[model samples]
Target: MRPQLHLTAPQNWMNDPNGLIYYQGMYHIFYQHFPYTCEWGTMHWGHAVSRDLIHYEHLPIALYPSKYYDRNGCFSGSAIEYQGKMYLYYTAIRYAKENPEYIHVQYSDDDLIASQAVVISEDGYHFDNRDCKHLVVDVIKDQNLGDVRHTRDPKVWIGHDGYIYMVVGSKVSNGCGYDGEVLFYKSEDGVHFTYQNRFIDSSIGDMWECPDILTIDKQDYMIFSPENIDVAPRPNSNAVIMPVAFDEKTCSLTKLDTYMYLDYGLDFYAPQTFVDEYKNRVMFGWLRMRKPVEGENWCGMLTMPRVLTQKGGHIYQQVHPHIQKLFNQKTNTIDFDEPFLMRISMLENEDVFLGGLHLYIQDDCLWCNREAISIHEDKVCNLTHTPPLNQRYDLEIYYDGQVFEIFINDGYYVLSQIVYKIIKEQTKIKNIELYKLSKIQ
Candidate 1:
């Protein structure tokens, strides 16, 4: 069972999910799993399936590195339906034999077969490593490219031209921790591939990992998570959703608009998305970049699945409505439209408003007796003072979902965060109560 709040795998440390596809009527998710430890170790593809995202059924480990190059592990990659078969193109988790600095590919003999006229397995969920760690995509050294030994995280797709293309994640400047690129390549036949170009730079402030490009509602999107220093319960740099226009002939990404984060939460990253049979652009990603809450015997988590929708060109992700069927709790209502003010007794003679609590001061100035206070009895959340200059800024909000995202000035900025975990859900305002509030505390 998944622990509440933080997501945990059934067995071990899981980084990112690969080979995600729906076959017959089931959804499959594979990830970089090290079953032996709570930490990083030899990589293997872990498997699970769900008719719905909420109820996941675990399966046997999908691919293992039983061969020489891949003996270390099967790192990360993607699964695609090609020529009527399901083919997984991923990185083989191996190090340099001579210098211990190189990386390679691992293959699986159990591929997607088209003759059956099924997506993955029309008969049922069954796959075998037929290739059995055979090298499929190799790291051939080229001038523009650096040490391929640091490459992994392969994303494959059928290009608009009906050919196959893959974008692999790699660390540049050699093995330097956080800098990498989503290296691009193409294959007339899904087997043989040649390097085309580096689509994105590694300097975008986060470890360049799990690069996926998606197009929804007549626009293109490039998805990636930053492995920056300030990870977890805080921004891990911001997960990027940049716009792109892929030139089918050139096979190069023309960077579109500015990059935006998928959510304001700290626990989300390494996301991969797909359009469902119904054409809804749904996405799921590894939740919480760090280890799990102790004693549960598992670490890492996956975010609640959400459908991607665009409004005024910005992609907005909302938790899928259906997940509520699995969830035991529900959010009550709060009036975001009406204004509410309060006055708590000044036990300490000073007032502190959290960036987490969103309070609109639209074009108005608020003066607190003090910037902070530490008493519980009585308080004041009055919206009385207007700015001397009559200028309004975004509302200041100290948020943890259940708490208000106090819209500062007209929703321009709500001082709220999703990176850290809060022990309690917010309750009724002591000094104020506006519209209906249904959320349980």
Candidate 2:
């Protein structure tokens, strides 16, 4: 089913969001895409833009596999504006020469070498990846600092000390296997970069991807994706948010607080954030899917842009104000006949069933169980939760037929997931404000 309020690719496969930024009065989102099929393949950067962050227009591909250094794929990265130009930095993949038969769906340690590069666009809509692309970091020569095949996903920004700083997801040898870490790079200019130091933590899993650093309420935090780590109640790769201490002079990061799952749902990963026009750190993430929904050619969707805030050392994600404006028309009941939004309050032990999805409050936690719909034989689909809740809490739910984005207690906790269909709903919320969301044109 086509989503009513979320951003999906024009067609085919899309994964991690790349090069998210607000530039020249427009919000540009570049994503990792494989255009020819509904399944993942050789990666290319697909482009889209919106003036108000609610409605988007698709553009031509921004970056692809062209040069020898990046012939295999153009992977995930971030965007920044420098000197009247937009600088898009991404990981460039080049497999070994003997691996001519390499398939992207298969994983092999000996199959690839990864590096970093940047492409500059004078105008936000136009990109010249062939002639303008420059190699900024080479993994082949810096193998001591990171694993040659795993170093990627460069997130760059200017520091308070007036130096261009970068954090790239990397892996360093721990004798038996590799441990995830982040490599810091210092640059006088945005293009030329030198490796300064690396940040390593034992809890950071086997490898990390899509590393992002942002300050909220004067506190720094790192957002990233890690593989092979088991978060409680879930046993796969997931997005993580952790409070950190960044040293501007040394260009390094130190962990300050424990990490938490960014979204407590199955279909979220590789999120990246950008400073919006309003100066809020807004984020978007790939709502991952195993396949196209039966007949559709597109297989992925993006979460509604979330404005992040911090309180008591924990990050909270609220729906962007532009999204709030779309649901201005008020209604009376919650229905899936079309997209809708609802705000309600529930006390402890209260349970509500919206067709196949089950929401309940128990054990001081708000839980969303969706096993009754869209069952997968290999994986359990009912594993969604929020952080511990108070005796009473408010919820804001945006239901777009097949997908749901739930914000708890004004986004102190968020849970986003996809369910195929809800045939019926139970439990009526009294004195609640339910609104019919405006359809995207």
Candidate 3:
């Protein structure tokens, strides 16, 4: 079952939200899309726009693999408005005709990929490569830049210093082994980027992808999904947040010892953020499914937009205010057969046990046990720990079709998953209030 409100490609495979920006009174979102199949293949930048975050209209394919520099695919990147023009900085991928030695020798010639390019648009809808030369940044052979094969996913932003800064994900060889590093670049104009330095080298993972920098309350935070991390209870790919302090004069980042997981869930990754007209740091992520839906034509979805804030040395995420307008107040009890929004909280001086496929808290953790309704052999259940609650705990759940999004304590922690089962029995929750979602036009 596809989502009713969450943004998904009309058809085919989609992943990694790219080139997110708000310009000219519209929110433009581009993503990694494969139009021909339900499986991953040649990637193109799929386009969509929304006047409000909740209602989206799919636009034409934004960027295709046409140029020699990006003939293979138009990979993930970010967008920025410069001089009344919107510029998209993307990793243009083209397979090498011959295998590069730095890449593993076992890889086939067709498997070798290179990332390099930028495109521009005047009206925020139409984009072309003619404005600037394609492949603005070429693959580097320098040992310090690490394995060129792993470099990609360019995220660019205009800094407080009024210079455009770009962070490209790459792997660095530190003699003994390769580690993930984010290479930094600067430009006075949107084009002609100059390599400044590598911003971060982390021992947490071997490669980093989808690097993003968010400046919150004068603190620069670097966020990325690292691959090959051996941490227990971690997904194959997970997003991490590193607190960094940036020096505009020198254009460098000093990473603090503190870092944390962006989301403690299985389905969240490759998030991109944009500053809204309200000056809020809004974020969205590709909600990754571990396995394909049995009968679906489309294969990916994005999480609901969240506003991010930092306080007391912790990052806080809350649902964007725009989304609350979609809540229908006609009902207070959920109808299991249809899409609904449910808010639950513990009763005063009361302990309650929710039954029949409902979420509940236990031992300082939020748990979802769907074994009662699950059709698959593998149990559909998960738990994420949160700070101990002295009183009632708050949870908001949005059930749209087969997907369920759980926001705990006003989004301090979130859990999103797809469940295929239909509840056959009545479920009860403490002080629950249910509302239907307004139908999307």
How much lDDT does each candidate structure score? 0.53, 0.84, 0.75
The residue-by-residue lDDT of candidate 1 on 1-441, one tens digit each, is: 233322346876887767777655667777778887777666777888777665677888777666555656666677777655667666664444422343222232111110000113223345555442345466545524643455666788888887788776654553444464667777787776777777646547534667887888888778876556343334445466888887656767877776655644333567788655566787777654344433546666665556777777767665455543333322333333321222222222234333223222333443322112211112212122322323543232322222222333332221222222222233233333223212322
130-219, model 3: which lDDT tens digit per residue? 545367788777867655567888898888789988888888777777788888888888788888877646566878889888889877
In the order shown, what is each candidate's alpha-carbon RMSD? 10.1, 2.1, 4.0
Give, for candidate 1, the lowest lDDT window spanning 10 residues: 110-119
Candidate 2 local Cα displacement, residue 45, angstroms = 0.5
> Which model, 1 or 2, shows the larger TM-score?
2
Give the poorly placed runs of model 3, Cα more than 4 Å off: 97-110, 129-133, 230-234, 290-292, 328-330, 346-360, 370-392, 424-426, 439-441
Instruction: Give the higher-lDDT candidate: 2 or 3.
Output: 2
Candidate 2's C-alpha runs over 4 A off are 97-110, 140-144, 231-235, 377-380, 425-431, 439-441
lDDT tens string, model 2, 1-441?
Answer: 688668889999999999999988989999999998988887999999998888789999999888998988998899989888999999999777544464554355666689899999899788897799999998655556788888899999988777889999887778888789999898988889988888998677889989998899999899999887665446478899999998878877899878888888757899999999999999999888777777687888889899999888778899899888889888776667788888878778887767677788888888888877755644434666776786657889888857888888888878887876575754445657788977666
TM-score of each: 0.68, 0.94, 0.88
Per-candidate clash tally: 52, 1, 0
